[model samples]
Target: MSKEILTTKDLHLYYGDKEALKGINLNFDAKGITALIGPSGCGKSTYLRTLNRMNDLIPNVTITGTIKFKGQDLYAPSADTVQIRKEIGMVFQQPNPFPFSIYDNVIYGLRIAGEKDKEKLDAVVEKSLRQAAVWDEVKDHLHESALALSGGQQQRVCIARVLAVSPEIILLDEPTSALDPVSSSQIETTLLNLRHDYTIITVTHNLQQASRIADRTAFFMNGELVEVDQTKNIFMNPAEKQTEDYISGRFG
Candidate 1:
């Protein structure tokens, strides 16, 4: 059995008077891809942010419940948010690479952490780009502005930036939603290859993408998890009628 890397119990969140997440309970395996799918405003993205305390950035936001990472309480008063974020990095929906050179973008985190060794930074940049499957395309253009690359390449570079930090888990929020089919496919392939090394959790609107790359799938509706199971079972033999209906295009 796979070890549980992250777990949530009765997790709840509110933005002022309105509730966003309603007692979410889920566990992520140490290694593999888990996709969160649902209609717009279903709280998948909000829940994803909660895992790394991203929601803390918003005013009037409040969270209640236990979120544990590696058996340590992520919400504990003593928990270090910066270290948590470093260990559980996030890739946003858009390919928001910094306006810096590709090499600088990939090394930004390390530099911020006080790493100044030229050799180590060079090695990490190359290794991360390779792991993100965009090394060959960007190797010759390492000094070029990241924005100069195509959307797909920029997204991959962003992924490399996250990998350079050597996070134990990666959170992707609709990562391929802004890309073309070809670009999306490339991102999917990169994710598939990364699953063996990192625990990945992604929010996606494309059911096909979820089925193709996710080892497990969780369906959410009205801020509540409708069902979660193996990808095959979730698509072929879901236990919930709502899940079946959504998967069959009946309703979201």
Candidate 2:
């Protein structure tokens, strides 16, 4: 069994007075891909954002629970939200790169963190692009505006930017939902390879994509986690009736 990197203990989230997450307790495996699947508006995205306190950006969004990273409470008063986000990187449903040169886009985070060393920035930019599998393709055009890249390449650049930050975990919220098939496949391959270095938690509505890359699958419904198990078991022999119904095309 792999080590548990992050654990959510009865997580509850609320947007204003409306509850979004209902006491979720789940352990994310270190160096493995855990896919969260469910119908639309099932709180998969909400749960993903809570890992790094992204929900805190919204006013009146209340979170009541302990999220532990390596057994340390992440919601503690002393816990640094910025550092937590750095350690737990996130990719959104849409490819959103900074409107700057490709190189600048990847180095933006470093610049914000007050890194002024040019040589170090250049080296990390090259290395992270390669890690994201787009270095060779974009090396000659690093100065080009990031927005000029194709949607898939832009998404890859976003990945490179996150990789450059050296996060221990990557949280993806339907990352491939906006890409073409080829681009989506490339990102999938990149994600598969990234698992060797970081734990991945993804919320994808695409059942096929979840089946392809997830080592374990979690089913959520109406803000509740219904079932979680290995990919094979979840798809072939789910322990819960709702899981079976969802997987067999009966319902979301």
Candidate 3:
């Protein structure tokens, strides 16, 4: 078995007075892909955001319990939000590239972190773009505005932006929902390649996509974790009736 790089224990969350997550406990393996799947409004995305403390941005949000990355409590008062975000990056549903050049977009995080070396920035741009599987397509067009690229290209650029920071984990929230079928396939392929270097935890509504890319699958419903198991088991022989029902399309 692989090492557990991250773990959540009795995690709970609330947005204002409504409970959003109900005691979620899950472990993420090092350099592996874990997919969170559920029906609409099931709190899977909420749980994903909590891993990197992204939920802190919401008003009247409260979190309890613990999220530990390599044995350190992520919600501790001394925990650094900026550092946590640097080590655990996120890619949202839409392809939101900055209005800057492709090269500049990739290096945006590094630049903000005060990396002033042009040679280093150039090297990271090439490496991150290659890791995102977009280097060959945009190598010669590095100076072109990222906003001018296709949606798929722009999403890949976003992924590259996250990768350039050398993060240990990448959180994806339905990253391909806005993309075309071909583009979605390409993004899936890129994610497969990325697992060799980064631990990935993604919230995906598409069961097929989750089965295709994840080593482990976690099912959530009504703000509670219903089942979690190996991908094959989760898809082929889920232990819970709820999981089977969801997978079989009886109900979401």
Candidate 4:
């Protein structure tokens, strides 16, 4: 059986008086991809942020219950939020590469962490770009400005940047929503190859994409987890009528 790397028990979150996430319980497997699917503002993204305590940055935000990483409480007062984020990196919907050279963008995190060894940084940059499936195309232009790259290439560079930090888990929030179909496919392919090394949780509004790439799918609606199961089962034989309705496009 795959190891359970992260888990939540009755997890809840609020922004001031508005509840964003109701009680959410989930167990995420190591080195696997789990997709969160729901309509906009249904709490899928909110829950994803909770995994790495990203919600803590918001003022007046309140969280309750337990989020555990390898059986350790993630919300503990003494828990290191910075460390959690380093281990669980996030890639957003739009590509947001820094206005730096391609090589510099990939090694940005390492530099912040005080790594000064050029040889080691070079090795990590190469490995990360290779893993993100964008090495060959940009290898000759490593010193070129990252902003000059196409949207898809920039997104892959962001992925490489995350990989260089050696994150154990990757959180993607509608990562392909802004890209063209071909670019989206490339990102999906890269993610598939990456599942052997990192746990990935992606929140997507695209139902078909979830079916195509997710090993397991969790359906959320109105701040609640409707159901979670194998991708095939969730798509072909959902246990809840609400899930079936949403999947069939009856309602979102």
TM, every model? 0.98, 0.97, 0.98, 0.98
Residues 48-162 of candidate 2: C-alpha lDDT, one tens digit per residue: 9999889888899999989999887998999999899899999998999999999999998898999999999999999999989899889999999999999999999999999
Once superposed on the true structure, which residue ranges of model 1 sit more than 4 Å away at CA?
none
Model with the higher lDDT, candidate 2 or 3: 3
Candidate 3 CA-lDDT value: 0.95
Candidate 2 residues lying further than 4 Å off, grouped into runs, are none
Give one clash count per candidate, in the order shown: 0, 0, 0, 0
The better-scoring model by lDDT among 1 and 4 is: 1
> What is the alpha-carbon lDDT of model 4 when measured against the actual structure?
0.94
Q: Mind giving the per-residue lDDT tens digits that candidate 3 earns over 111-200?
A: 999999999999999999999999999999999999999999999999999999999999999999999989999999999999988999
Off by over 4 Å in 3: none
lDDT of each structure?
A: 0.96, 0.93, 0.95, 0.94
The 10 consecutive residues of candidate 4 with the worst lDDT sum are 1-10
List the lowest-lDDT window of 10 residues for candidate 2.
1-10
Who wins the lDDT comparison? 1
Number of the candidate with higher TM-score, 2 or 4: 4
lDDT per residue for candidate 4 within 78-148, as digits (tens), equals 99999999999999899999999999999999999999999999999999999999999899999999999
Candidate 1: pairs in clash: none
Error of 3 at 241 (Å): 0.6
